[model samples]
Target: MTLALYSGNLLAQSHEWTNLHDEELRRRAVKAAGEKDLPALVSLTTAFLTVQGKSGVLTSPRTVEAYELGVRHFVEFATAQAVNILRPGRHDAQNYINTMLAAGRKPAGVHLKVAAASALYRALRWAGATEADPFREARVPKDPTPGIIKRPPYTEDELADVLDRADTHAKFLLFLTAHAGLRISEALNLHWDDIDEAAKRIHVRSGKGRKDRIVAMSTSLARAARHYRGLYAPGGPDHTDGKRTTPPENVFRYAEMTTARYHLSKAFKLAGVDFRGFHPGRKYAGTRLLRQIKDFGRVAAHLGHESVDTTRKGYASLAADDLKDDLAGW
Candidate 1:
């Protein structure tokens, strides 16, 4: 009777003493945080992000968001094999790293996943749920050189087909990405005042890495922008609540990236072309400009790259075989 009472007391007390049955590392991760499940984990993540922001360790919401994304991605990868979140060893870390590497993702992309995995480890430790740091022995993967065969840029014809079929707002947004080589965020964040139709240049304020640049517009892009601007003049979709509004402040202000993705996909379906995600639009632009300009330095300047090497390595860099045709001419 005394032994039974003791056992009951142990069961009722802190769960850490008991060998808990965790399903696929999910329970272990939550329980390690002294949490019940995913909700608790999310709550812990939010709390951690808030603390990080307040402490100035990570002041930007965008940075915190990136961390959160990394956390979720890591959790998905690590929990696949179901390790003890509280007692995860080096093997678990290696598994995640290996799995990510094996997936053939670009090194830059894999680096984000690895950093995110590390962030989750930090969160767990900071939450006082577990002192375990599974990623302690984690190693970063190696980045590979860029080649033409790698991540084949979408063709101009594909872009044209999709552009012709897109809705009014989508056309302007996609035009910037496809022709101007603006990132999706850059295109969306554009203001009407930033457009210089006479100059034929689109000012990309705060592009990737917070760098700003101007992208010259194509004839088609200029025409599309003029058409969209014409709509902005009267009671158009951009100016629905027209109450003394001079012009729409942000060009694609009402357009959401998610909605744009949907529209792009729909347009591709209608055009009978395969649709990759929007970044391919940037790739298409870069490759086209590189070929037309035939100079990596010039292409880099046009694309607003901080370095010519980046332009050469990413957009204009051709594989050894791809340069064979030019070699014959040489």
Candidate 2:
């Protein structure tokens, strides 16, 4: 007979987790147990499940799997260093960094691993497991991975050419993402309820770090959305019976990342634009908005950045031309 340990009431005192049903509890347990013998894994997993669940992102299976994998990697590193299962230290973190280097992990991959481990340490600390955060002392190598290089902004003529070549729905999605500075995930996850035609704004309920903000929609974007809506709406003889009415809660699911890549690759080759994908479009939008818009705060709000500094860092390159023009005038 196998004895099953009941891990109940761990969250009984916490109002946030107390109301969680059976399915949520089981999911949390499974995620926590993914790692081998990180003594506080169970508690850390519970914390993640609670926090992310409240943030409305815990429903994404992919996100949960990524968390589990990250936890597993940390556990493996901790075990190799003979770190105390419940009380890891700075030396353990150092050893893990050396081991990762020895295994030929790239700087970015190592950074992610270290960051993930740090998150786990923080989680464990939150759960009353230990006082030390070994990751605080875990030094990332001197040569940190370079940030992603911003691609050149698309010229107005090039943009027109790409739009003309793209399919109708693809064009609209591309325009929204590139012109509006929406992330691919945010743009793809948009629903009809989020759009306010009269207000000329779209509420981005989900953003990076689970923050919410509203972005003003361009007239072109609003028009395209209305057109897309009409295309998806049921009408004519097809809806005579009235039973096949389109659902009010519909969202456009065109051009997923992989599909977008395939189609955009073909479009790029045909247009000879040397552009790759939608991310460049976002960069273009950000750069253009920063350069053309007089107010940094408004630009930051439109792009849903926490601060103007983030906007500056992302869009500073766009100012080079303005600087050149000023020098010429001087």
TM-score of each model, paired residue for residue: 0.72, 0.65
Candidate 2 regions off by >4 Å?
1-46, 49-66, 76-89, 98-111, 126-132, 141-162, 196-200, 209-212, 233-248, 254-278, 327-329
Q: Which residues of candidate 1, in runs, are more than 4 Å off?
A: 1-66, 76-82, 100-109, 124-133, 140-148, 233-238, 241-248, 253-255, 307-309, 318-330
Alpha-carbon RMSD of each model: 10.6, 7.3
Measured by TM-score, the strongest candidate is: 1
Cα deviation in Å at residue 194, candidate 2? 3.2
| Each prediction's whole-model lDDT (CA) | 0.65, 0.61
Candidate 2 lDDT by residue in tens digits, 194-265: 877678788887676667888887887788777766664344222233432234353454424556566666
* Model 1 agreement with the true structure over 1-330: per-residue lDDT tens digits: 011111222223323322334342344454744322443454445445445534332233345456556666665554666766666766888787777778877767777877766666665666455777776777766667564446667786877787778887678877887788777767767888888887899888857656778889999889988998877634565566543322357776454467667767888888888887776777777778876666777777667778887767665544346567678967
lDDT of 2: 0.61
